[model samples]
Target: MSLRIFEQRYTRMVKEACGSESGFVICMLNSQGNKDLNEHIYPIGTYVNVVDFNLLDDGLLGVTVEGVRCVRITNIKTEADGLRIGDCEMTAPWEFTATKELLYPMDKKLEEIFKRYPEVNSLYETTNFDDPIWVINRWLELLPVDAEKKQEFLQENDCSKIVQYLSGLVE
Candidate 1:
């Protein structure tokens, strides 16, 4: 949920988000290329709320954001300053429910990861070990999967595919 804005061009967008009433920004990973960001971004992205921003030790902008929900982005446009804008329609949050039995080793293993990497732990103020959606989503984020795979999983109407995928990893 935290992001480091290093590029000077992108800092303006963060600052503007801070000043906005909602403090929300839609974020998607940029693919490799010299193409514009609008061309590189995936159709789905997380709309995050800017919780805090500070100057990092390395003189970059360190921003802590909270993921609000998923959105499907469309109708991309570009500004003169090279900023990409798009229409974001709120998409349903992945309706995955997890019981203690389903979460099993994955929940415990995630705690181990947090303990091993405090930097990752510090990104969020709280974590819900009981929330199946949260556990699976966090695991999904940690997986070294391709963007296409991740996007395809998110686009599903239910979590059966993801459940199978995560079960394979957790076991």
Candidate 2:
């Protein structure tokens, strides 16, 4: 996934992460920053691997990061430079099975849709349509669902449900 950090305050941290062997951490806060720091100090986040980065003329540092896994922050402390550091524990990754019986028709349907809408094909240039997980995840991304609904589906972790949902959407 791509992460765009536009704030000027994070430029140094982003540059340092790009240079380091260990990449960066991405957190999802349950609430806005108005909460007491001690009340919700340690938030869960994703540990990511930086694939590549570029400095843009607009002063925005563009970085491409692939999520490694989910991590829960057990403890957090911020440095003097305003960088937040955390001690985290890796959470169990999502589990799913991609049966060929489930994937065959899905792949065919996706191909048909792509043919009808050639403009969107570029998004899947490096994706493997034959892989059921990839197909489902890509469909989830392309679907016109709201963010909250998409997040719910992602957290569900049931591939069959996702496949069924997409199949219905395709219909």
Candidate 3:
């Protein structure tokens, strides 16, 4: 949840989230230079709850955020401050059903990765491995994929597809 605010578009959004009661919306743009706000960006994003804010010695802002839920953004607009605002439609809480037994292998792989890296485990001490959604998000965060690629997984409503994708990555 430590996000480095490298882009101007994100700086204002993160700052505003620090003061807002509802938290912030983070939509992943397809391209870094994509200035077209009218273009349909990915609908899904993690509604982040800003827990801690710090101004690092390197002059970069380090934000500690927690994913509250998945949100679908619509009616996006670019503000004068370069921050994109939108109406967020929150997705209902999702958990893996018993039918998706294919997730078991992905779950095992995630457990193995965590056990092999205590540093990673310490970062996710509060995570519940029993939840498939949690496991998928953790894998997405840990994987070396770009933001847009991770956004692709987030947009998928089916947990099995995400688990399958992660399993494929590990395999």
Candidate 4:
């Protein structure tokens, strides 16, 4: 299915498919094509869940969705809890499938980065973070975005790039 990138209008009652109670503010997008033609304009009060996340080029984020078919988002307005898409205001809950191969290397990379940057060791260890992807995203925010360094980071399926990037930072 073809991936469609649309500006999220914001969702209400955002929860993970695993059944989380409290909602989180998240933007949802889909990788597979929407065959139903749900229209592209989103109204307010749209509920949604994040099925998958992938880092895109030029600092864009990629998300894949599973449920709540036919999302049409025209313009999005930011609100206190979520954004209002057109006038719909809907909530969409979704599920994500995580693979071991994808996660294991990310953990390994973060650990290796910590070893190199001992100064940030505590930062790495003490935090009760959700997963290695969070750490990697954080690191990406602070570290310099050198092409060679970024290439080095993207070279491996794991965190070898993290070490390479961290070492560059310390140097």
Question: For residue 119, what is the lDDT in candidate 4?
Answer: 70
Candidate 2: clashing pairs of residues? none
TM-score of each: 0.84, 0.64, 0.78, 0.25
Single out the weakest 10-residue window by summed lDDT for candidate 2.
33-42
In terms of lDDT, which candidate is strongest?
Answer: 1
For each candidate, the alpha-carbon lDDT, in order, equals 0.79, 0.66, 0.74, 0.42
- Candidates arranged by lDDT, highest first: 1, 3, 2, 4
Per-residue lDDT of candidate 4, residues 16-104 (tens digit)? 33256322322333334242342322122223445555657755545554323222234455455444333333323222134434445
By TM-score, rank the candidates, best first.
Answer: 1, 3, 2, 4
| Candidate 4 Cα errors over 4 Å, as ranges | 1-96, 124-130, 146-171
Expressed as tens digits, the lDDT of each residue in 1-171 for candidate 3 is 687776776777776677675588666666544467556567687788888888888888888887788898888887887667889888876556755466677778888888898899888537577777777778778888877767666666666666777778877
lDDT of 3 at 92: 70
Residue pair clashes in candidate 1: none
For model 2, the local distance difference test gives: 0.66
Model 3 clash pairs are none
